[model samples]
Target chain A: MSGQTVANLMRGHIEALAARGERTDGRGANEFRDVSIETGLIGTAEGSARVTLGETTVMCGVKLLAGTPYPDSPGRGSMTTTAELACLASEQFEPGPPREPAIELARVVDRGIRESQMIDFEGLCIEHGEKVWVVFIDMHILDYGGNLFDCCTLAAASALAHAKIPNVQHGIADKDVDLPISCWPISCTFAKLGETIVLDPNHDEEMVMSARLTVAHDENGNLRAMQKGYNGAFTVDEIKTAVKTARTADKVLRKALKEATK
Target chain B: MAGGNSDIKFIKKGKRLDGRKPDELRKVRIEVGVLNRADGSCYLEWGNNKVYAGVFGPIECHPRHKQQQDRAIVQARYTMAPFSVNDRKRPGYDRRSSEISYIISQALERVVMVEQFPRAAIRVDMQVVEAHAGTRCAALTAASVALADAGIPMRDIIPSCAAGKVSDTVVLDLNKEEDNYGQADLPLAIVPSTGEVVLLQLDGHLTPDEFEQAFDMAYKGCMDIYEIQRAALADRYGGSA
Candidate 1:
């Protein structure tokens, strides 16, 4: 069969399964896949974490360097997020500069961490406006099982939590210090299959899903970031339900993140 | 471990710094078909280096001009993650990666029977998630297995290994510290059956006698690696091949 025909068949199969309140992986609509997070896996980086959401795996590394702070945020440290969806992760990802999917993944993960104020940026300043710590968060997609947004965000947040300022290396201080983390923000992703929204869609489910929604919540249950993906639209009721699902899902993730970082 | 290079003893007595003999190769572990989305993939951990290789293709070539009328084009891209080394590498392709990618493509192309698929393209992507030393050899070895796992026809599975001179002794495989302070480095890829040297790269300094010894050591290392490659494939295919 042609590729599209096979996709259509899979889509039909998924919709049929969804209507029965089940997923292809035999999980409930609100259930998430197994998540395992390991922190400090990359020795070179100040902090790093490897997250596995089911079969999908992503590695996030935090590299801190001393540089001139931005003029707009002079007293605060700066953070730049970048995501690479290398061809090694999947055949669909080509070898080139960052593409749309990668850029989108980075931005969504960035928004969750930055908007949540998870890192105490002001404390990172070495000198009033001259020199400050700049943190680079790099998200590398090693395996594309699915639900990359949530996985990337989790990896980034965990890595940030594990990060320490390389003060001695940068000649800013006599010893290293832990990054000031104020809050933990966890993201949950869901895909709409026909009329049903499934939490943490795997690769096949993502390929056939109509729309994607990712919701990030902080420790206090405040929604910090939201992203709507794909060309499909969701009903107002579906949006409300997604937020509720995300809030509940983040509880498990936050606990896992804490354990991993600790 | 600190101060001057000469102060750091790369070799002591009969063993190297990591407590291995000069001709010892690091422990290697290979797992094939690790990625579900790729046509074929392999995850390799050699010493402290973690590398993944994925093969995609024999598909129609993009940008028509890049296609060859008589043979498929093999394009290999080698990338190191930002946190792969002691210092974080900036994201994006750099001169070193470009050179390694080119050399890897040339090496794989020699063994892959590309002429059968005209106007097509085969892409091999090698990502180094962790690096100690000899990443190029590990990447090439993994890529060759990934190609075979993808069911691509080839003259033979290519295995690569590196030997370098440290503390005036030619070692079979150099680790991170040895690579940093080693006198000479020689990385080579060979077709075990045909004994053809497809890839050869050298750096540092070596006497003619030392060069021959290193070459012999590297070849032996490759032959050892070739057996592991075959076992990996057999494990995946139930020993049919």
Candidate 2:
């Protein structure tokens, strides 16, 4: 059979199974795959974490540089987020510029952290308008099982939580300080397969899912950011259900992040 | 930037900063077939440096004009994660990375049995997730294992390592400080079975005698790494240790 034909057959099979609240991997409609986070793995970077959600693995590193602040945000620090979907992670990801998916991924993750006010921007200021710490969050997709959004978010949050300001290295102080994390925003992603919404879609499910939604929430259960993806639409009730599910997922994921860093 | 820091003592009591002897290599661990999506993959950790290499294809070559009528071509890409270094590196292709990729592709082409898959291309992706020093050597070594894991036939696995002059002494497997402040650095990769050196690059300064000594040290380091590479492949294929 042709590649598309095989994909169509698989998609039909997956949707059929999903309609019964079942996943091909035997997961429930609201179940997540195993999530593991390891922090401080990269000694070269100020802070780093590797997060694996099921088989999809992403490594995030936080590097801080002292530079002139943007004119608009002279008193506040800045952040630049970028994601590399290298072909090494999967054959589907081609080499070249940051294509649509990668750009979207980075921006979505950045929105979660920024909107949540996770970092204390004022703490990063060295001198008002003159110099401030710029945090660089670089996410590397090492293995592409699926659910890159949640994996990248978890890795970035964990790495930032684990980061330390390079005070001594920058001659700003005698010792380094923590990156001044004010909150932990964990993201939960769901895929719409047939009429059922499943949490944490794997690569195979991702290939077949009609729509995807990622919702991020902070510790207080307040929604911080969200992104709806693909050409499929979600019902009003489905969006509400996703938000509720995100609350529970945030608790579990945030606990994992805390344990890994501690 | 491989020379000219005079203040700090790189050698103390004949021991390097990390306490390795002159010829001792940093601790290394290699695992094959680590990534699921690729045909073959390898993850390597040398000291604190971490790298992943994956091999795909003996498939059709793209952009028809690049095809070799007689044999497959090796397309190797070497990339460092932005956070792989102390300072963040801009993502995407830079001149340095392009050069490294070209050199690595040429080196792999020499070993891969390309004639078997005419007009095809073998893609090798080497990612330095975390780097200390000697990443090029680490990347080359990991790529060789990844190719083998892909079940690609080759004359031999290439073993790569570096030797350098720090504190006026030839040392094997230079670390970050050594590479930055040392007098010379010589990275070498060879086809272990034939001892044919396929890759060699140098920076800084070394006299003829020091150069020969560094080369010998690097060759020995490669031999040691070769054993580890063989063990990794065997471990993956369930062969005898």
In terms of lDDT, the best-performing candidate is 2
Which parts of model 2 have CA positions greater than 4 angstroms off? A1-6, B6-9
Q: What would the per-residue lDDT of candidate 2 be over residues B1-241, giving only the tens digit for each residue? A: 4456846688899998999999999999999999877889999999999999988888668768999999999989999999888777888888888888999999898899999999998889999988898999999999999999999999999999999988888999999988888888899999988889999999988999999999999999999999999998888788764
lDDT tens per residue, model 1, A1-262: 2233556679988899998999889889888889999998777789999899988999888999889999998899989999999877775676779989899999999999999999989998889889998889999998888899989999999899888899888777799999999988989898989988889998888888889999999988999999999999999999998998788877778888889987
Q: Which stretches of candidate 1 lie over 4 Å from their true place?
A: A1-5, A171-174, B1-9, B235-237
The prediction achieving the highest TM-score against the true structure is: 2
For all candidates in order, the CA lDDT equals 0.89, 0.90
lDDT of 2 at A213: 99
Q: What are the clashing pairs of model 2?
A: none
Write model 2 residue lDDT over A22-129, tens digit each, in one string. Answer: 888998888788989989989879999989989898989999999999999999999999999987887677777899999999999999999999999998899998
Candidate number with greatest DockQ: 2
> Model 2's CAPRI class?
medium
Worst 10 residues of 1 chain A by lDDT: A1-10
